[model samples]
Target: MEKNKEVSANNKVDVDSRRDFLTKTPIPELIIKLSIPTIISMLVTALYNMADTYFVGKISTQATASVGLVFSVMAIIQALGFFCGHGSGNFIARMLGAGKVKEANEMASTGFCMAMIFGIVIAVVGNIFINPLASAIGATKTSMADTKAYMSIILIGAPFMMCQFVINNQLRFQGRAVYAMVGLMCGAVFNVGLDPLLILVFDMGVRGAAIATITGQFMSFLVLLFISLRGQTIKVNIKNVRLNGFYLKEITNGGAPSLFRQGLAAAATLLLNKYAGKYGNDAAIAGMSITTRVMMMLGSAVIGFGQGYQPVCSYNYGAKLKDRVREGYFFCVKYGTIFLVFAGAICFIFAPDIIWAFRKDEEVVAVGKVALRFQACVLPCMATTVITNMMLQSMGKGIKASITSSARSGIFFIPLILILPRVFGIRGVEVTQTIADILAMGIAIPFAVSELRKMKKME
Candidate 1:
C-alpha cells in the first residue's frame, strides 16, 4: 500500500511538471524541443513511403506507375486517419489544458474506436470493388494487375494503419512526441529492412512491397497500442467511447480541415493521374507520381515543424495564454519559410538528377524534372499555407481551417488542372500545383493574420 501510494504521488508530480513545462517554457526552446522528434517522425514516414517508390522504380515504369496509381487509395486511408486523429487529438489537448481529463479520455477513446470501425469498413468495401477502384484511380491495362495487388494488400491493413496514426497524433498533442517518434521510427526501420528482402530476394514484386508496408503498419499499431494501454497519457478505453453528437460535432469541427485537405489530395491525385494518362502515357503518370511523392517527402519537415507548434497553440489557447500561441505562430512561420526556401532551392537545382534517382526512364525524368522545378519554385508558399491551416485547426476554428485547407487541392487545383491542360497541353499538368500553392498562400495569409491579431487582443 505504501509503495503504491509513492508511485501515485510520483505520477502526480510528473504530470504537474509537464503542465508547468508546456505553459511556461520559452517559445523558441519549447517549439524546438517538440519539433525535433516530430520532424524525425515525419521524415521517417516519408522515407518509408519513398522506399516503395524507389524499389518499385527498379521493376519497370509500368510497375512504378501502378504504385503511383494506387497511392490515391493510400491517400484516402491517410485522410481518414488524420481526420480522426487530428480531430480528437486537438480536442484532447485543449481538454487537458483546461484540466478536463475525463473529457480528454472520452475523446481519445471515441476517436480511436471510430477510426478502427471506419478502417474495417473501408477495407471490406474497397476489396469488394478492387478492380473498379483500380481503374477509377487511373490504372491502365498494363498496370492493372500490379495496382490491384498492391492496393488490396494495403486495404487489408487499413485498421492497423489508421489506428496507429490516431495514437501517434494523440501522443503528439499530449506532449509525448518522443514516444510517438519511437513508435513510428521502429515501424519505418522495419519497413525499410523488409522492402529489399521482400521485393528482390523473395521476388514478390509489388505485392511484396504492399506486404512490407502493411507489416510495418501493424507493428506500429502494436507499439502505439502498448503505449496507450500503459495509461501514460489519455488511456483509450472502450468504456469511454462516446459515439454521440457532441463528440462527433467537436471531431468534425477540429478534423474537417484534415478531411478536406487529405480527401482533396486523393481527388487531385486521381485527376492528375487521369490528365497525365490522357495527355501522355504511363511514363507521364510515373513522372508526376514521383514528383508528388518527392515533394511531399521534402515538405514533411515543414509540416512536422508546424505540428510542433500545434500542442503549444491548443494547450495555451485553452489555458488562455494567448501570448504564447501568438509568439509560437510567428516564430514557426519565420523559420519554416526560411527552411523551405533552402530545401526548395536544392530541389530546383537538382530536379533532373532527383527524378532520375527514382526512375531512369528518359520520358519519366523529362516530365518529372520540369514539374519538380516548377513546384519547388513556389514551395516556400506552403510554409505559410500549412502553418496557417494548422494554427486555425488547433485553435478550433474549423470552418476557417477547412476553407484554407481546401484551397490547395480542391478550390484551386481542380479548376487549374481542368483549364490549363486545355490551353497549354502537358505543361498544364506540370504547373497545376504551383498555381495552387500560390493561391493557397494568398488565402492563408489573411486567416493567419486575423487569428494572430485576435490572439494579441486576448493577450
Candidate 2:
C-alpha cells in the first residue's frame, strides 16, 4: 500500500509538471513562440509567390496576367490539400487529447494516402484538359500560352504539394510545428533561389517559375516525409491505413467546410479574371494579381496565427476543458485583429510602392493602388471572420463552420461580383470585396457570441 501511494505521488508530480509547462507559460508568449515560426514559413511562401510574379511580370503584361489566370487552378488544388490536412489534423489533435494514440496514427496515414491519390487524379485530368481548364479559369488569347505552361508544371507537381500539406498539418497537430515550419521554409527558399536562375538564365519565362515551384514542392515533400517517418509523435503506417467508412465520413464531413471556402475562393478569382478580361486589356488582370498577392501576404500571417491557435483549441475541446477553448478563441481574435489592422494600414500607406514592386506599368499601378487601399481597409474585418470561422471549424461544429466559410465568397461575394460590376463598372470591382469583408464580419459576430455563451454555459 505504501509503494502504491508513492508511485501515485510520483505520477502526480510528473503530470503537474506538464500542466504547469502548458498553463504557467504566458499565453501570448506561447502564441508568439508557435506563431512566429508559422509566420516565417508563410512569409517565405509569400516571398516565392511574389518572386514568381516579379519575374513573370518582367516578361510581359500578358505573362503577368497569366499568373492571375492560373491562380484559380492553384486554389482548387489548395482547397483539396487544406481539406485533407485540416480535417485530419483536427481529428488527430482530438484523438491525442483523448489519449488515443493509435487512432491518431491511423488518421495520419489515411489522410496522406487520400491526398496523394486525389492529387494524382487531378494531375491526370488537368493535363488532359489543359486548354479547357485554362479557359475556364479566364485565360485570354494572349495569356493562354503562359497560363498553360505554368499550370502544366503545377498539375504535375500536385501530388507533392498535397502530400506536403498532409505532413505539415500532422506535424503541427503533434506539437512539432517547428518541423513543419522547417519544411515549408526550405521549400520557399529553394523556390526563391531557383526562380531567377530558371526564368532569366534558362530563358524559360513563366514555365521556369512553374518548374522552380514544383522542384521546391518536391524537396519539401521529401523533408516532410522524413520527419513524419522518423521524428513525429504520430506514426503513419501503410498497413494500418485501412478505409474505415465511418472515419472517412467523419474526415470528409469535418473537412467539407474548408473545401467550400477555398473552392469558392478559387471560383471567385476565376470570375474576377474573366470579368477583368472583358475590359480588353491585360492591365486589369495584372493589377488584380498584384493586389491579390499583397493581400494574401497579409492574410497568410493572420491565417498562420489562427492555425497556431487551432491545435490548442482542438485539444482543449476534446479534453472537455471548455474554458481553455474560449480563452484560445478570444486570444486568436485579439492578436489577429491587431496584426491585420497594422498590416492593412501599411498596405494602404504604401499601395503604390507595393504595386510598383511587381510591375512598372503605369496602368497596372494605377488600378492596383485603388484595389490595394480598398482591400487594406477591409483587412481587420476579414481577420475577424477568419478567426471566428476557424474557431468553429476546429471545434468540430461543421454545419456552422461551413456556413461561415461560404458566407464571404459564396453567399455574398459571388453574387455581388456578378451584379455590382454590371451596375457600377470597374469601380465596382474595388468595392465588392470590401463590402463582402464587412458583411462576413457582421455575420461572424452573432455566431461568435452564441458560441461564447455556450462555452460559458458549459463552464
Candidate 3:
C-alpha cells in the first residue's frame, strides 16, 4: 500500500496548479512544454503502425496490401473513438476553465462510456459482416484472405483501442499531456517488440501481426485507464456516466469536427485503394499505403502541436482570455510551419530512398516515390489547416470546424479522387493529396483570420 501511495504521489499533478499553468504561463513555453510529450506520443503511435507495415512487408506483397485495406477500417474505428474523446475532452477543458469541476467529471465518465459502447457495437457488427466489410474497404481478390485474418482480431480489440484514445485525449485536454504520452508510448513500445516476436519468431504470418497489434492496444488501454484515475485529472468512473441530451449536444459541437476529419480520411482511403488497384493492382495499394503511413508520421508532429494548443485554447477561451488564445494560435502556427518545411525538404530529397526503405519492389518504389515527393512539396501547408481546425474545435465552432476538417480529406479529396485519375491515371492519385492540402490551407487561413479579427473587435 505504501508503494502504491508513493507512485501515485509521483504521478499526481495538483489540480489548481495545472489550471494556472495552462491559463497563465508564457504561450511559447506553455505550448512547447505540453507539445513535446504529445509530439512524442503521436510519433510513437505512428511507429507502431509502421512496424506492422515494415514487418508484414516481409511476408508478401499481398500481405502488405491486406494491411493497407484493413487500415481503412481502422480509420473508421479511430473516427468513432476520436469523436467521443475530443467531444468530451474539449468540453472538459472548457468546463474546468469555467471552474465547473463537477461538469468536467461527469463528461469524462460519460465520454468513456460512449466510446466503450460504440466500440462493442463495431466489434460485434463488424465480425458478423466481416466479408462485406473487407470488400467495402477495397480488399481485392488476392488480398481478401489476409485482410480478413488481420481485421477479425483487430475488430475484437476495438473496445480497448477506442477507450485508450478516449483516455489519452481526455488527459491531454486536462493539461496532463505527459500522462497521456506515457500511456500511449508504453503500448507502442510493447507493440513494436511484439511485431517481430509474434510475426516472425512464431511464423504466424499476418495473423500474428494482428495479435501483436491488439495485445499492444489492450495494454495501452489498461495503462490509460489506470492513469485516468490518478493525479488531479478527471476520473473516468462508471457511476458518473450520463447519457443526457445536453451532454450529447455539447459532444456533438466539440467532437463533430474530428469525426468528419477521420471519417472522411477513411472514405478517401477507400477511394484511393479502389483507383490504385484499378490502375496498378495489389502493388499500387501496397505502395500508396506505405507513402500514406510515412506522411502520417510527418503530420503527427503538427497534430501533436495542435493538440497541445487545444487544451490551452479551450481553457483560456472559457476563461475569457482572448489575448492568450490569439497568442497561442500564432505562436503554434509559426513554429509548426517551420518544422514541417524543414521536414518536408528532407523527405523530398530522400523520397525514392525512403519509399525503397519500406518495400524494395521496383513497382512499389516507383509508385511511392512520386506520391511521396508530391506530398512533401505541400506538407508545410498542413500546419495552418491542422492548427485552424483544432482551434475552431477547441472553441466550439462546430460548423466551421467541420468544414475546415472536411476540406482536405472529404470536401476536396473526394471529388479530386473521382476526377483526377480519369484524366491523369495513376499519377492522379499521386498528386491528389498535394492539391487538396494547398486548398485546405487556403480555406483555413481566412477562417482563422476572421476569428482573430472578431477577437480584436471584441477587445
Candidate 4:
C-alpha cells in the first residue's frame, strides 16, 4: 500500500512537471521541440501513403487510377478521425490548462469511443454498397475490380484506423508528440516493409496493398492504445467517458473545422477525379492523383507544425494567457512560411522529375508536371491559410474556423473545378487547386488579423 502510494505521488510529480514545461517554455523553443516529432510523424505517414501509390503504380495504369479513386474514401476516413481527435484534443488541452484534468480525461475517453463506433458503421455500410460506391468515386470499368479490392480491406480497418488517429492527436495535445511520433513511425515503417513483399512477392496486387495499409493502422492503434492505457499522458478509461450534450458540444465546436477541411478534401477529390475522367483518361486521373499526393506530402509538414501550435494555443487561451497564444501563432506562421518557400522552390524545379518518379508514363508526367508546378508556386500561401484555420479552431471559433477550413476545398475549389475546365480547357483542371489556395489565403488573412486584435485587446 505504501509503495503504491509513493508511485502515485511520483506520477503526479511527473504530470505537474510536464504541465509546467508546456506552460512556461519559450514560444519558439517549445514549438520546435513539440513540432519536430509531429513533423516526422506527418512525413512518415505521408510517405507510407505514397508508398501505397508507388507500389500500386508499378502494377498498371488502371491499377494506379484505381488506388487514386479510392483515395476519396481514405480521405473521408481521415476526416472522421481528425474530427473526433482534434475536437476532443482541443478541449482536452484547454481543460488541462484550466486545471480541469478530470474533464480532459472524460473528453478523451468519449472521443475515442465515439470515433471507433463511427468507423465500424462506415466499414459495414461501405462494404454493403461497394459497387455503387466505387462508381461514385470515379472508378473506371478497368479500375473497378482493383478499387473494390482496395476499398473493402481499407473499410474493414476503419475502426482501428480512426481510433488510432484519435489517440495520436490526443497524445500530441497532451504534449507527448514523441509518443505519437513513435507509434506512427513504427506503423509507417511496417507498412513500407510489407508493401513490396505483398504486392510483388505475394502477387496479391491491390488487395495486398490494402492489407498492408490496414495492418499498419491496426498496429498503430495497438501502440497508441497501450500508451494511453499505461496512463502515460492522458488516460482513456471507460469510467471517464461521458456522452452528454455538454461534452459533445465542446468536441463539435473544436473539431468542426477539421471535419470541413478533410471532409471537403474528400468531396473535392471526387469532383477532381470525375473531372479528370471527363477531360482525358486513366492517365489523366493518375496524373491529378499523383499531383495531389505530392502536394499533400509537402503540406503535411506545415500541418504538423501548425498542429504543434494547437496545444499551445488552446492551453494558453484557456489559461487566459492570450499574449502567449498570440505570440505562438505568429511564430509558427513566419517559420512555417519560410520553410514552405524553400520546399516549394525545390518542388517547382523538379516537378517533372517528381511526377515521373511516381508513375513513369509519359501522359501522366505531361498532365501532372504543370499542375504540380502551379501548386508549388502557390504552396507558401498554405501556411497562412492552415495556421489561421487551426488557430481559430483551437480557440473554439467554430464559425470562422469552418469558413477558413472549407475555403480551399469546398467554397473555392468546388466552384472553380466546375466552371474552369469548361472555359479554359484542360488548363482549368490543372490549375484549380492553386487558385483555391490563393483565394483561401485571401480569406484567411482578415480572420487571422481580427482574432489577433481581439487577443491584443484582452491585454
Candidate 5:
C-alpha cells in the first residue's frame, strides 16, 4: 500500500527531483537553497524567545529570574524531543539516500510516536512535582511563585511542543526544510503577537507569557502535521511505528549526540543559575540569563547554516559520494567562520545596550554587559565547533559527534561553572561560557581533521 503511493507519477517526479537536488546541485547553490529557510526558522525561533524575555522583563526582576530558572526545564524537554527526532530523522535521511524508502517511512512514524509519548510523560510528571522541580532548577524564595506559575503551564503544553520539534526536525532531515520553516514561522509570529497582548494588555504577567508559548507550540504542531500529510513527503502513520530493539538502537546511534548536547545544556543552565544566585542573587541571575539569550540569538545563524549542510553530508555519505560531503564541509566552515567574526565584533561593541534592552536594572546591566562581551570574544570559534558536531552526527559517527557536542555545554561548561565561581565570584560565572567555547574548539578541530583525512584516504 505504501509502495503504491511512491509509484504514482507525481510522487515519483517529486522524489526524483528531490534526489537530484540534494546530490547534483552546485555545492554553494545547494547549501544556500536549504540554508535560507532553515535560517529563517532559526532566527524566528530566536526572536520569539527574545519576545518572551522582553515582555516578561516588564514585570519585575524576580519575574525575569523566574523565567530564566524555568529555562532549564524547557531544555530538558527539548533534549528528549531532539533525541527522538534526530535519532529517527538521521536514519530516515540515510535510508532515503540509499533508496530504502519503506524503512525511512517506518522510522518517521516510530520517532514521531516516541516523541509524543515522552511528551505526555513529561507533562504528567512535571506538573506533579512542580514545586520541588522548580527549587532544584535554582529558583530562590523571591522567584518561587512566578516560577511555579510559569512552569506548570509550560509543563501542560509539553506534548505539543515536543511533537512540534519532532515533526519540524523530520522535515529538515528529509530535505523539506521549507515546509518546516513555514510551520515554525506561523507559530513564531503568533507567539510574538500574543506576547504583549497576554503579558501587558491582559495583565497576565509571567502566566500570560507561558500560555502564549505553549499555544504557539500547539499551533506549530498542527501546521507541521498538515504539511506532512498534504505534501508528497513521507507520511507519519501510527501503523508505521516499529518499537522493537532494532529501530530503537538505530535511533540511539543517530540521536545520542543531540541528547548529550541538549541534556548537558539543561544541566549546565541549572548550575549557572544556581551559582549566579548563590553569589549575586536574583539580579545576577536575570543579567546572566539575558546574556545567554542574546548569545543564542547571535549564534542561531551559524547553527542554521550548519543544519543546511547536514542533509548534504548525510545523503552523500549514504550514497558513497565522499567528494560531495567533503566539499560541503569546507564550504560551510569557511563561510560560517567569516560571518561569526563580524557578528562577534558588533555584539562586543554594543553589549551594554543589548542587555539594557531586556531589563533596565543596573545590576542586571552590569552583569550582562560583561557576560555578553566575554562570550562575544569567542563567538567566532563556535562555527567550527558546531559544524563539526553537526557533520559527525549527520554521518552517524555517534561517539565522536557526542564528544564534540558535549564539549561546549557539558565537558567544559559543567566544570567551569563549578570551579570558576569558587575562585572569582560572579566574575567566574560571566567568563565560563567563553572559556568553555575556546576549549571546545580544541576538541572539535582534531575530530573533524581525523574524519576528513579518512575520507581523503578513501578517495
Candidate 6:
C-alpha cells in the first residue's frame, strides 16, 4: 500500500509537470491539444442549448420562444461574463508567456472577484426591471409570463454563471483547457439530464428549465473551483486581490471586444424580437429564436477553433514570435472556414428538420426554415469575423478587435434588421441576417488581409 501510494504520488507529479510544460510548448502543438478540449467543451455547451430548445419546445411554441425572447437578457449577462473572462484570460496568457506568474495570479483573482460583484448587480437590476425588460426585448403578452419566469431564475444565478466563465477562461490561460472542459462538460451533462426531469416529469414548465440551467451552472462553478485549487499552478490570493488600476485597465481593454460583440448580440436579439413581434404574434418571436439558436450551435465548432487559437496567438505575441503568431492566425482562418462550410451545408440541407427539432408548429417551421437556410448559406463568410476578431484581441489590438467584434451584430446587423424588415416584411427578416453576415465578412477580409501583410512587413 505504501509503495502503491508512492507511485500514485509520483505519477501525479509527472502529470503536473507535463501541464506546466504545456504553457511553454511549441505553439502549434499546444494550440491543437488545447483546442480539441475546447472544441468538445463548446460542443457540450451547444448540446445544452439544444436541450433547452428541445425541452422547452416540448411544452409549447410559446414556451420555446419565451426562451428566445429572454435570450437577449442572457446575452447581456454573457457579455459581462465574457468581458471579465476574456479580459483576464488574455492578461493571464500574456503574463504567463512573459513569465510574470505573480501578475497572472493577481489578474485571475481580481477578475473573478469583479465578475462576481457585477453579476450580483445584474441579478438585482434584472429582477427589479423584469417586466419592462421583457417587454423591451419583444415579449408579447402571450410570451411575457414565460419570459419573466425564465429570466428571473437566470438572473438569480447570474453570479454563478459569471464566475464559472471567470474560472473557465483563467484555467484555459493556464494551459489547462482539459480541466476547463471537464467543468463545462460536467455541468452541461447535468443540465441535459435535469431538463427532462424538471420540465416533463415535474411539470415545471419554463421555470423548470431555468432552474435546471441554474443548477447546471452552479455545478460547473463548483467543478471549476475544485480544478483551480487542485490542478492550477497560479493561486488566487484574496489578500493580494487589491485592484491594480493598470492591470484592471489592461484586462478591460483586452476584453472590451468580447463585451462589444456579446453586448451587441443582446441588442440585435432584442431588436429582432421586437421587430418580429410587430409583424405577427409570439410565433414570429419563437421562430427567430429557434433559428438563431440553431445558427449558434452550428457556429460553435468554429467559435471553439477560434477560442483554441486565441491563447496561441496571445502567447506567441507575448513571446514576440511574430511569425508563429501570423502562422497560427492563417491556420485558424483556413480551418474555421472549412468547418463552417461543412456546417453551413448541413444546416442548409436540413433547415426544416433543424427547425422542427425545436418545435413542430407548421408556421414556426416554415419561418424558421427559410431563416435558417439563408443564415447557413452565409456561414463560411460569417466565420471570418470570429477568427479575425479573436486574433486581433489575442494580439492585444483592442481598438481594431472591438471594431471587428461590433461589426457583425452592432454596426451592420442592427440597422439592417430594422430597415430591411420595414421594407420587405418577414422576407426582409429572413434575409437581413444573411446580408449582415456577408457585409461583415466583406469588411473583415480587408482587415485580416491587411493585418497579415503588416505581419509580413515586420518579417
Best by lDDT: 1
Q: For model 1, what is the alpha-carbon lDDT of residue 402?
A: 99
lDDT of 6 by residue, 286-312 (tens): 888899888888777888888888877
Better of 1 and 3 by lDDT: 1
Question: Candidate 3: which stretches are off by over 4 Å?
Answer: 1-13
Q: lDDT of each model, Cα atoms only?
A: 0.92, 0.83, 0.91, 0.92, 0.90, 0.84
Give candidate 5's error at residue 391 in angstroms. Answer: 0.5
My TM-score estimates for the predictions, one after another, are: 0.98, 0.94, 0.96, 0.98, 0.98, 0.94
Q: Estimate candidate 2's alpha-carbon lDDT, on a 0 to 1 scale.
A: 0.83
Candidate 4 lDDT over residue span 203-297, tens digit each: 99999999999999989999989988996447899898899999889889988899999999999999999999888889999999999999899
Q: Which clashing pairs does model 1 show?
A: none
Worst 10 residues of 5 by lDDT: 6-15
Pairs in steric clash, model 2 = none
TM for candidate 6 is: 0.94
The pairs that clash in candidate 3 are none
Mark the regions of model 4 whose C-alpha exceeds 4 Å error after superposition: 1-12
Question: What TM-score quantifies how close candidate 2 is to the native fold?
Answer: 0.94
TM-score of 1: 0.98
Kindly report the root-mean-square deviation of model 2 from the true structure over all alpha carbons: 3.8
Tens-digit lDDT track for model 5 on 340-392? 99999988999999989999899999999999999999999999999999999
Candidate 5 whole-model C-alpha lDDT, 0 to 1: 0.90
lDDT of 4 at 324: 89
